[model samples]
Target: MQKKNNYHFETRAIHEGETGDGWSGATLPPIFQSAAHYHESAESLSKTFAGETQDHIYMRLSNPTNRFLEQKLAALESGAGAVATGSGMAAINNACMTLLRSGDEFVASRSLFMSSYTLFTTIFKKYGIRVRLVDPLNLDDIEQAINEKTRFVYMETITNPGMEIADIKQIAQISHTKGIPLMIDNTLASPWLCRPIELGADIVLHSTTKYLSGHGGALGGVVVDAGNFDWTRERFSDFAPFVEQRGRLAFLHRLFKEIHVNFGTTPAPLHSYLTAIGLNTLGLRMERHMENAIRVADFLKDQPKVEWVNFPGFEDHGCHEMAKTQFCNKGFGAMLTFGLKDQAACFKFIDHLDMILNIANLGDCKTLIIHPYSSQYISFSPALKNKLADPQLLRFSLGVEHAEDICNDVAQALEAI
Candidate 1:
């Protein structure tokens, strides 16, 4: 959120991506649901294929509606540009595939979301791309982990289930010292809370299915490039062609041209349109989400049956000061996990909830609850599961509902235990 720093956040969120319909001049973006765009002349179509014009050749390559969403996402993240993908996992695949070669290796956070952890350790490993995982809070260990084989440094702005906040500014410095770009998964913090690029990240990622959609009605992802990284360096020699042609937009160009299109991680125009609409109310929703979260976290901390509440919002948390500084004190976040006596108690409590859903998803307008140990990482070994976070904890993604109502539901659920 740097170059767009001149505009107020709320104003940009609603206005930045809006390119009205050509025929109707509609205020909202019109979904271009066609499979391909036809031009009157071959020269016109040829120019677009040659990358001379920004016309839509095919839906898989681009769409007018998706462009609007991409623009708003880039502006919200203060990036040079952004590219949309079919899903969050697709976004990660496109990004890592764009840079990592067979022999290359990268460093990532140990407390990653389960899918990301599996992708890094399993699929990428099968392809001969190794990942070195480290604790998010260990800055010294992170700095030491980098070496000649490291291509880039990656981490989540806020760890998903763990809800840990790492120092983005310091970590960015560390990555830059090794002449590697820093990639941040900003899905949890959302742009309303923090923008990693302005703090020093070169690339930012988001799962629009989460806070960006706010309503949890869309499933999409975006990759935003800061245009601040130097791809002309010898280490990034593969990007030489893109740097020469696309200049500062080299990463975005390679992403769309080589990875996203060929890999077929294209998002539907309807999802883009709905996400664009949902984005308009992000600022308001995030505030209410945060307020409700603090109220809920505080309530859980005092419960006799609850063993512990793990939320960075509280001052007792080790990362509290860093989260306060990083998020500019907006509020810690809307996600938290609290422990019960055991996993069985967690399941019993979840079964008794009246309003909160037991769905696997998070960041929904309707409050969601899940027992991480049994559901999210059920296949993981006991040691690895505990290493990430407490296996007995119940994760909560608080909604915009009233604080009193959310607390009351928790009270009733606790009584069942």
Candidate 2:
């Protein structure tokens, strides 16, 4: 879809996907809650199934509302196209499945979403796809990890929970020089905060259920193609199977059209509508979220009781300057991690928070807090635990709420500590 001129980010967010469908001219895109589409005749059905026509055959293949979201998000991420999936893990799995096969490999940052890290190490590895976990902040480590079998380099734009930032431009250059794609999971730094595609990333993936939705209500994910990588440059022989003996659909073309449908992890229409509603206010909400985060980080940094706080926005923290260059005055996103006095203090603070949700989720309009050790990373093995979790860590997803109120809640909770 072509992005029209004069429509700023915020404007595009609100108006990009709305269409004048046959129903009443609704200002918002209507939820196309459908399971299967009817065909006029058997001939038409054959055409649809044979890829001769582009129309929804089943909800598992495509849905109107999801298609609208895919188009809008593709434009937002500065990509050629996008595909939505059931959840963030589904999106990651789809990308991995499309790129890597048995004996193929990929490099990923060790600091990743706990669930995603598990998926890569446990599930993808089980399929003979090897994942080499490295510190993405070190360009040398990334380069060393890549070998002949490596298909791509994957990492989160902003490391999850740890808040470590990656030098995307440098990584992109390294990957491109080696004739490989640089795939980044951009959930932590949403499009509002950073666009990895512009920095030469080949593909950008998102768990839209997070900051993009700006709410915890919806569940969905997206994989956007930057359209920058030249698939014709043939380093990957896996593209051979997709070619079908004809020069028809190249690498990504076949993946998006065929593999996506065959896998059948398509996102639902209602979820897409909710995600659209959340995206419209993304810029505004992120602004407040960033502001609140800076305040919270500053507050925690000064607390003697607080052992340490890690936020890319804070100058003392690692990667603060890099974050300043990457994230436009958005102050390095709303997530910040801190070490409290003890486990007892962690529970006390969580229990005292009257306004914030103490759920295992993040990026909601309301502030959300979690003790990562007991919640998200609980399943990690002793060895993996050393790599994934910090015992004293308390992760906070600062929301758009008043900074003073948030601080007061933390203050009362700390007093109990």
Candidate 3:
């Protein structure tokens, strides 16, 4: 059956990646585990090497399993194409390296994932790429920060453990006005909750290792190009190489053929295989995650010992309204961060959790909790880290567990604190 563009997300999630092979007729996509494919003829090899034909020549450049995941994600995100990477940071790094040059600027939200902030401050800056941090909630701040050298505006759909929602459309509009593209990390707000591309973003990214996989077993990331931004636009001279060669698909085409392949950041076929299976149940899992999260947030908000809670679904949250406008009716997301009485209480709560896992990761089938100051933000300087990550903050990632049971576990943990 031919697929339609108007297909619902739930349907697309399962059907988009499956391509039945002529010989096997296998319902499941078999991992193309080999490292290389032999070219049938010199003409075919020339076509493939010259980009005249889109065939897998080397696993480092492309793999059938990775391509399936890429196709499915591209369809789900409403993107023109996608590139999968070995890890989430690789996706961000490659995107920056491909689009930015020395002295080029990119605006980003201040309260982003710690690793991203570190990437901007330590890594990207080392290459002379400048990162300008701004308040994500302020449109004026975004406008003021952008200048002629600006290449893109980047932010998370929902700020990491902070759980603050961003006005994606507003930001995208601001970026477009300046001939800059808006790039969003939609890891926390997977397409099931919010489709960033449809909200006016040019590039949507993900750490598929998280919720998309629903399991902590694999590590992978993807960058999906919305095909909205015109690379031919004169401001992006960095894109000249691709346009001079590959035309419209300049950015993604070069990214896949050069930066991704040459840098050796390709996603493994095995990881793609597992992520594909995980995506099959994303809709069902996200629903349960939303349900459990809301219940947990509501329960946390009422506790006398808790100092503050930040969940976009909460009326008291800074971006509750923005979240309501941007996300599907399923509530903000499955993630939230709350403050306890103090640092001591935070550790006590985390250490006492019975059912929830205390690992540093989020977006899992089993509930996960962590003290950001120690786990996720450990690499930063003490004073600066405190500014970025509150010492008393506890980040919670709701899972597909029973709400009541999850609530009870949180309650018991709080009581112990």
What tens-digit string does per-residue lDDT give for candidate 1 at 288-372?
Answer: 9899999999999999999989999999998899999999989999999998999889889988999888988877788888887
TM-score of each: 0.97, 0.95, 0.97
**Which parts of model 3 are misplaced by more than 4 Å?**
none
lDDT of 3 by residue, 1-417 (tens): 477767778877888865755528776678888999899899998898887887879999888889989988898888888999988888988887778888899999987888888998788988899999999989999999999899999999989866778899989999999998999999998989998889899988899999898888889999998887888887977678878886766888877767898999998899998898899889889988988889999998898989988888888777888888888567789998899878889888888888899987888999999888887778778888888888888888999988889889888988897
Better of 1 and 3 by lDDT: 1
Q: How much is the lDDT of residue 11 in candidate 2? A: 76
lDDT of candidates 1 onward, in order: 0.90, 0.83, 0.87
Model 2 local distance difference test score: 0.83
Task: Provide the lDDT at 415 for model 1.
Answer: 100
> What is candidate 1's CA lDDT for residue 349?
94
How far residue 319's Cα lies from its native spot in candidate 2, in Å, is 0.5
Write down the worst ten-residue block by lDDT for model 2. 243-252
Considering TM-score, which of the candidate structures 1 and 3 is the better prediction for this target?
1
Error of 2 at 253 (Å): 3.4
Prediction-by-prediction clash tally: 0, 0, 0
Model 1 / residue 266 / CA error / Å: 0.7
Candidate 3, position 332, lDDT: 82
Best model per lDDT: 1
Leading candidate by TM-score? 1
Q: Which residue pairs overlap in candidate 2's backbone?
A: none
